[model samples]
Target: MILENEIGLSSFRNERQKASISILYTYGFLANCYEQFYKMHGMTNQQYNALRILRDQYPKPVSTSFLREKMLDKMSDASRLVSRLSAKGLVVVTQNPTDKRLVNILISETGHQLISDIDSDLYKLDDLMNGITEEEAVQLTSLLYKVRNSLKSTYDNTVTEEQVHA
Candidate 1:
């Protein structure tokens, strides 16, 4: 809705600007869904993402830097988020034995159980995509990848050209 208001998408739709507008609109919608999903657990989106990452890393310790790298948004403060999870007793943090300067993180038993309890609620989020069939989802994914790859190539070309000009 915000994208619709700000982007004035109706005019450019079905034209040259459609791809970019569609990407922006889709992101806005997905972000709203993310907000609603996290709200059910009284957690922020980043916090939920951190918890899920930790769950996937269960039985193995993860580093703050490693988490930052894996996060969907690179701007997130992984160290601070990990600290908050530790404070909530949902994660345990300790100094790495081999490298005192680095910290190791593990999902606490509480965190494991919490994720398990919320599994159903998380799946309920799939309803947001119910209008699309499985085949459509796959096609959407392929088109998205194509768009991303094209963008990446364009960016790389620009960077290389700039460097050459410099």
Candidate 2:
């Protein structure tokens, strides 16, 4: 179905605007699915993401800064996520010995078990894309990369306050 039919919109300014809105709407749809899935396990998406990162890192502790950079939503508060996860006993936060001001986090045993339980659910969620062929998915990925790269070039060239100061 066309975006118009999907959203009940009469029209968009052009194909470019339509495509942009389509991406955003599709993202919202996917996010809603993820939220519901995560909620069933008693964790928000951000908390799940944090636990996943820590689980992936395993024995190694990761800094809040690293989590911030790796999170799906970069604008979210990593410190707050750690605090919540800590309360849930899903992770352990420790002060960095070398830098007392910095904190590092690792997934706890409960977190690992939680992830193990949810891993299958996450895979099943991906199976929803089985409606599309592998080739179609690859083409969609390529197009998204092209769109992002085009925007990245423009963003990377823009001057920032830190860059100006440096």
Candidate 3:
């Protein structure tokens, strides 16, 4: 369905406005699919994201700060996610040897097993994107990167100028 029909709006101010709203709406739509998929396996999307990060770092512990920095949702509370995963035996947390105030996390064997299980069914989530062709997906990815670069440059300049004026 067209964005206008889906959102029940007759028109947008411009194509840029339409594109922006479509991106946001599509994100919410995709995020909901992810949320439901992860929920079935008894975890939030943030928790799954953390597990994947930890799995990649497997054997080598990572700081909660590292997880937060790498997470898809920047606003996620890494410490809380760690605590919950720990409670579920999905992760192991230990005090940082060099810094008592910091904790290091690692995915446990059970965590790895859960990930393996989820991987088998992951295609169901990927199928949501079957509406778009592989070439379109690549183009979409490049366009999204361009958008991020534009935003980042603008934001960096704004912050720098603000600091200078202050």
Candidate 4:
């Protein structure tokens, strides 16, 4: 389906506007797919993301701040996620021995089991990109990186200007 038709818009202001809208729309579509996939496993995408990070770093506890830095969703409250996972017995949280102000988090056996279960069906999630070839996927990734780099400079300039004005 055409993007304009899908969005119910006759046209965009220009190619740039169309591209931006397309990216956002595509992201929403993909996010919805991911949400459904994770929900089937009784977890939210953020929770799964945190678990995956913990799994990768298994046996070595990590801080909530580390999870926040590594999470795909910057808006997620890592501490809250850790608390929720703790409540579900999916993770273990403990006060840092050296730094009482900080807490260490590790995936529990239940968490590891859940992750393994999800991994068995992980190919379904990867299939979401079946519309694109491997080469196109690589190209798309590169393009997104370029876009982020450009946006980073723009964001930095805006923040600098705001600070200066303040």
Which candidate number has the best lDDT? 4
Candidate 2 lDDT, tens digit per residue, 22-53? 99999998889888888999998998888888
Which candidate model has the greater TM-score, 2 or 3? 3
Mark the regions of model 2 whose C-alpha exceeds 4 Å error after superposition: 160-166
lDDT of 2: 0.90
Question: Where does candidate 3 stray beyond 4 Å?
Answer: none
Instruction: List lDDT for all candidates, in order.
Output: 0.84, 0.90, 0.95, 0.96
Error of 3 at 135 (Å): 0.7
In every candidate, how many clashes are there?
A: 0, 0, 0, 0
TM value for model 4: 0.95
RMSD of each: 3.1, 2.3, 1.4, 1.3
Residue 52, candidate 1: C-alpha displacement in angstroms:
1.6
Instruction: Work out the TM-score per prediction.
Output: 0.83, 0.90, 0.94, 0.95
Candidate number achieving the greatest TM-score relative to the actual structure: 4
Candidate 4: clashing pairs of residues = none
Model 1 C-alpha lDDT per residue in residues 1-166, reported as the tens digit of each score = 4555676644654554666876877788889988888778767788778888989988899999989988987899998899888888989999999999999999999888877777768767778889999999999999889988998899999999999999
